[model samples]
Target chain A: MNINILYAALAPIVAILLGLLYIGIGRKIIARLQRRYGPPFYQQYIDTIKLLAKKTVSSHGVFFSLGPIMGLAGSMVTLLFIPFGSAAPLLSFHGDIILVMYLVVIAPLGMALGVGEGSNPNGSIGMARGLTLMLAYEVPFVLALFSVVLYTHTTSIAQIVQSQAGEWSLLKFHGFNWLTFALPISAIVADICLQGMLGEKPFDQVIAPHEIASGPMVEYGGKYLGMMVINHALHIYIETALFVDIFLGGGPVWFFIPATFSVFILSLIINGVLPRFRIGQALKFYWGVPLILAVIGIIYTMVVIK
Target chain B: MKQKTEQKKSLNQGGKNMTEEKSIDFFEYFIGPQHPGITGNFGVILNAVGDEIIKAQANPGYLHRAFEKLMEQRMYLQNVPLVCRICVPEPDVNEALYSMAIETLTGIEVPERAKYIRTIVLEMARLAAYLFYFGGTAATLGLYTLPNWSFGDRDYILDLFEELTGARIYHIYMQPGGVRRDLPKDFTKKLYSLLQTLKKRIKEYDGIFFDAALFKKRTKGVGVINKDMAIEYSVTGPNLRASGIAYDIRKDTPYLAYPDINFNVITENEGDFYSRVMVRRREFEEDIKILEQLIDKLPSGEVWNRYPMPLNWKVEKGDVYVKVESTKGEYGYYVVSDGSEKPRRIHVRGPSMTHGIMLLEKLLKGQRIADISPIMFSLDICPPDIDR
Candidate 1:
């Protein structure tokens, strides 16, 4: 019980640090692509520490002060619920997939509540865009999730990972029994949804600096902004790790780290080249292409299950 | 308490019935003078509902240095440095236009070689400005790679300028009678190589930025100025050409060595933000061809014609409006001289005076808030030009 308690304590710290490292490395990759000598891979760690160390922090009210805390708390809770690999399902329960989904939303909602109290139109608009974007991407994402759950006959994330473990005889795919190969269409749809969830262009409208001035975090500064940065790092880990667990066969740590980092780097490469879509355009895209693909994937899953 | 009751009564009476009335809450915010997204030290007061802009007012004067009024207090030569500061990105246009105005009023005919040299300087400035436009427009749309590439490429042009004029940004090279100095040794060879490098790099820009589907989808038809509207607003340069109007000051009024050089006035019919940007993109190539031709035909003679003694020079009483085709638009200088060392009055007609204020305000109405920066950049509205 003490070892389990210690593992629970260690999981979030490891996740946050690894997430920051991925972001810093992603920045370096984008810089190299653009012919620039980017900052060191630990630049995010330095930035977070510097921001947290700053003394002055302005607040609009109780909600303003509570916003970053709530966001950090929400991301922490979401991270705890999602299993990172085979060895570490920190706080995962039998029906935690549904709980994880609900928890994933709390961070942005908390952010909205806090930014609303700040009385900034940019922040409000950012929150609105973010929520609207959430609504758009969630449709396809939920459909993909449903397909994965139905194919494996489980709502428990651990069972889902166990289901993807053994090899299939009909397809005779050898090395890894990841669902990405078994349910290819659903996996593709989920990856597209992941692009939106990650907030990389051509879908990065929420914090479009040129459009609305960094959106929800426009007025946040000092420690509040620092917390948001930490929350963002954790948020990245949670979203990508969830994808890995569902599609990539939540293997040991060796497999999990590379799989997650590759997924993130793919998004970063796309982000470096593409311009942002307008909010309306983003909605239209999510509803049109990925939505139809998601519907087809669910139908395929249903047919295969029968 | 009475005022509150009166306000409530007025609100109720303004509509026929409360159930039939709808109130829109406009979110008003200022987008710079301190914001990063803005092009320069400029501001746009945006009144928006949701993500759509209901109204946008161009808030100029943040970078106002009263350049026109200051020119009145200085001599013709003294104002050359001051005028260049009016437009930061492409300062050579100001120097050329100011010198052209003074030369015309004083009737100081520049030498044959000087005209060629001036033409070379002007085209180089235009090329540099277009490079800046590519980086800035791409950055506003969030394709950060193009900015890194194009801005790095622009430094090559600035290096050439520095070698010639002893300054990188504000090169006060164009003097009243002619250029301040002749071309340095092997300058043409270096320019030819730079053009070769740019020709190769432009394809990379096309691969990443200009031909990218997302860039096209974002910019096409976003900030359109139809030909009729373009003419009504007196839009000039690449913007005017983009609207299918083939009006080019370089072609219509042959200045410097343009009459001898062979180049087409690049135009696009769509008149949208994409067309505006494409016009400049094609014009970059056209400018390269013009510079190559100028170097091939550069004559060997004096670059500067001797004027009257400095610090006591006087001009003949006259007024003249000399205009040049800058990268943005028709940059004109109206100089009225009462035959004095300092002119009686001078008026600078920067292209941003029309494009940045009236055209920008008109284009921004009903546009999504996301498009504000991209449209401003597409029009190439340098704020200092407007403020000055």
Candidate 2:
């Protein structure tokens, strides 16, 4: 129990560091692609440190103070529920995938509540768009999640990861057992939903800098923004790790690192080139294409199970 | 309860049904001089519901420096330095237009070589401005890679300007009778190589930004100004051409070395944000073609004719309006001289007077809040031009 507590405490710190590193590297890659010298890889760490060390931070009320704390808490809680690798299922329980899914939403909800208290129109607009986007991507995301759960016949994230460890006869051409190969349709749908979930363009309307002045974070500053940065880092790690655990067959630390980093870099590459979709267009796209694909994947999974 | 009833009664009397509850739904915000999304020191006061803008009011004068009034006090030659301050992006156009106005009023003929050089400088400025436009428009749409590419490329043009004119932004090159000096050694060769580099880079730009499907989806049919609306708004330059009007001041009026150079006025019929951007994109190529022709046909003569002593240079008592096709639109300088060392009055007609103010306000109505910046950038509304 003490070891588990220590692991739980260590996991969020590691996730934050990894997420920050990912963002820094992503920025460097994007900069090189644009033919410019980007900031150092540790730039985000410096920024977060500077923000946290700042003396004064204006507050909007009790809720405003609570927002970033809540967001950080939510991300930390979600990270704990998921298995980091095959060894570190720190706080997992039966049916924790459903719990993790619901817990993942608390960060944005906390942000919405906090930004609502701040009462800036841009922040409000950002909150609205972020929630609307959540609604849009959730349909396909849930379908994809359900397809995986049904195929593996498990709701615990640890069991699901364990189930995809070895070779399976179905679509075992290369002796691959990852769901990405087994349920290719669901994997693609989930990857598409991941793009939206990560808030990369062309679905980056929630924090579109040019459009709504970075939306929900418009009014946040000092420690509030600093906390958000940490929350964001952990969020990135959680989302990518979740994708990896479900589809890529979560293994040891070495495999997990490269698999999650590659998934993030793929999204980053897509983010670098595409212009943002308007909120309406993004909704239409998520509903029209990925939703249909997710449904098809689910039907295929059910038929395979039968 | 009483105040609510009064508010409801007044709202009902205005026209449409608007309850106190419903009226409060309209969220008003200022996208301003401090905002990153905004271009320059400009602001737009928008009344919106959710993300859709209901009304937009152009808020100008943030970067205002009373140039016209300042010009009234300075001598003809002294104002040369002052005129370029009106427009920061394409300062050469202001200097050329101001000089041309004085030249017309004083009857001091500019040398043929000086005219060609001025045209070359103007075209280079246009190319630089278009490059800036690409960066700004792409950035507003959240595709930041193009900005880094275009801005880095723009430095080459600025390098060429620095060699000839001794400054990157505000050159103050054009004098009343001619340019400040002749071209530097191997300047054309350097310029030619830069153009070639740019020409090669344009394909890469097209691949990344111009031809991106999402860029088209975001920009196409957004902020569309029909041909009739274009005419009504008095939109000129690439914007007017984009709206199906093939009229170009350079082609129609035949200014400077334009008569000698062969080029087509690039136009598009869509008149939307996409076409406006496309019109500028194609015009960048046209500008390159014009520069190439000007370089080939550059005459051998004195680049400047010596004007009178700077302190005592007097002009004839007459008014003249000299206009040039700037990268933005028709930039005109209306100068009235009272035969004194100091001119009587000077009026600068920057294109942003229409584009930034009235036209921007009209175009922004019913547009999504996300499109505000892109639309503003596509219009190429420089706040300094409006504020000047």
Candidate 3:
């Protein structure tokens, strides 16, 4: 029940395992889409280990070192907050969803800090872009989060998941049923928008290799780059876990296997199928379409239930 | 309000302050040497009134490799790889132009098929380089998605080049008297299919990227170079053609197989940043047309001549200047041979040296800071051209 000790004990191992699984499935899906063989599930683990074992070089600042550490910490926090397979979460408290929101944001903030501290103007520009993207997506995301919390009449994610066990909370509650459809749709859109903000292709605007020469990563080399890579992998892992827990509740006994793997495959398939969105277009989609969807979901829940 | 002092000073000083007060304001910024907005390793000292650039002075020679001087010291055969480095984006043009100059000087008539092969390679390079233009231009306008799409698509072209020339980017495949090898079986079919694929993609690209509101907002009328200014600056290629000058070296001079092909000299009436980008976009379509025709009418002959094994070959004492309307502009190579295997003097008068450096400096002055990249991309300056 004590949060700190529980997180200290299980966070790194679970996070690392989930990170590897996520990367493994992601690589497989991307490979399939590109018509090639994806790497083994543990390839990312091997890569991280090799990078960490190598000598580190610093061209910029202490933030370069701090970025990955904080990113990993942020991901761990997100992982700890999620209800794994049962009703109990690793960390539980009233209004903890707010904590989760802030916790999820820390990775990008840490990354932006690290890149800005690296003193490469490209990195700074990329940080600015990443920050702007956070602004665009986070507002609607938080609003959607509030809508879900409102429907359940509880801020505890465990309670919400438990409520779903009987008849699926989304459908069990008659008045808030529309909130379920709307929230998931908005969440998926938000996540897709955030993925680009996370610097994947099509949305890899901040560090376009040829244009800004890898943007914020332009000056990074050796182990510093390795840490950034690990940080990103972990971030994706935690974000997907959160998505699974919120939208696609833990299914049958083998649900975690399929649910977790499916999310990774979906993300990769999305990455392969779509090109990047421009900054303005991205902002417009997140703030415009996703915001409208979140509003409709909230309105449907309020009018139907309470 | 600040004009009062200036008016008083001008009146007191007999109206001479306009010409005499040429010093830059103390808050001037020099964005180059290692700065954004520049095409490559060069600098421009800017006198800015806030974000507005009041004056811009061109600074060159950072990437300057003394290529002409380097060319003079190398033997004719040894210079093949050396010349290709002159204009990195369109390196094949350098090889073609240099070899054409050598051919003209030595009176070695290349086989008809080799000429066609050379023409295809040159046009492909032009297409690839224009794709690069789309990337750079789109990025300049903050439509970052266009660059990603264009660059990803560009790899397809590079894939073709890799298969054909055994190297991507700098294909040192074009040699004197012809190409290094004959076209592989079904090379024309594959090329045709690739062109068709590129054509379909271009339409989608036009809808999503080039025709977007942001592109229009950033580029339209931002940097307008009229026909007079274009002529005065000696701007060529798309920039010159955009200003309504229909002077294309391929059409005007008709070197290699350009004379045999039926392609129009694409011209735009407006010489602004948008017009320049439009001209290149139109030219991409034109390049597809040229490639289609080249494949249809390709002649049958030897791809190359023995040419005395290159290193052993010698040119009689003579001077010649060969010009080709490359993707950029008038790519001219002037060579003076003293009846030796090596040339006595070689000068690469690439268009970028004038357009990228001199004309860029002139146009960038009095423009806003955001306008810098689009204008630079509009000129399509291959930085290596200036370095050479």
Best by TM-score: 2
Fnat values, candidates in order: 0.68, 0.76, 0.00
Q: Which digits, one per residue and each the tens of the lDDT, describe model 1 over residues A75-165?
A: 8878777776665576766778999889999999999999888777778778889999999999999999999988998898877877666
Docking class of 1: medium
Clashing pairs in 1: none
Chain B in candidate 3 has what TM-score?
Answer: 0.92
lDDT string for model 2 (A99-171, tens) is 9999999999999999988877778888999999999999999999999999999999999888877533334
Better of 1 and 2 by lDDT: 2
Model 3 interface CAPRI class: incorrect
Which candidate ranks first by DockQ, i.e. highest? Answer: 2
> Candidate 3 lDDT, tens digit per residue, A1-306?
776686567766766667676777677666654445668868888887787778865545677778766766777667778776444666788877788888888887877777766654446555666777778878777777767777778887766665555333433433232323545655555566446544565456566443344566665666777777766766666666566566655343345446656666665655554444555556786778778877886776676566
RMSD to true structure for each model, in Å: 5.3, 5.1, 8.7
Task: Considering chain A alone, report the TM-score of candidate 3 relative to the true chain A.
Answer: 0.84
Fnat for model 2 comes to 0.76
Q: In candidate 3, what are the lDDT values of residues B193-218, reduced to their tens digit?
A: 99999999899888866676655655
Q: Give me the displacement of residue A232 in model 3, in angstroms.
A: 2.1
Cα lDDT, all candidates: 0.87, 0.88, 0.72
TM-score of each: 0.94, 0.95, 0.76
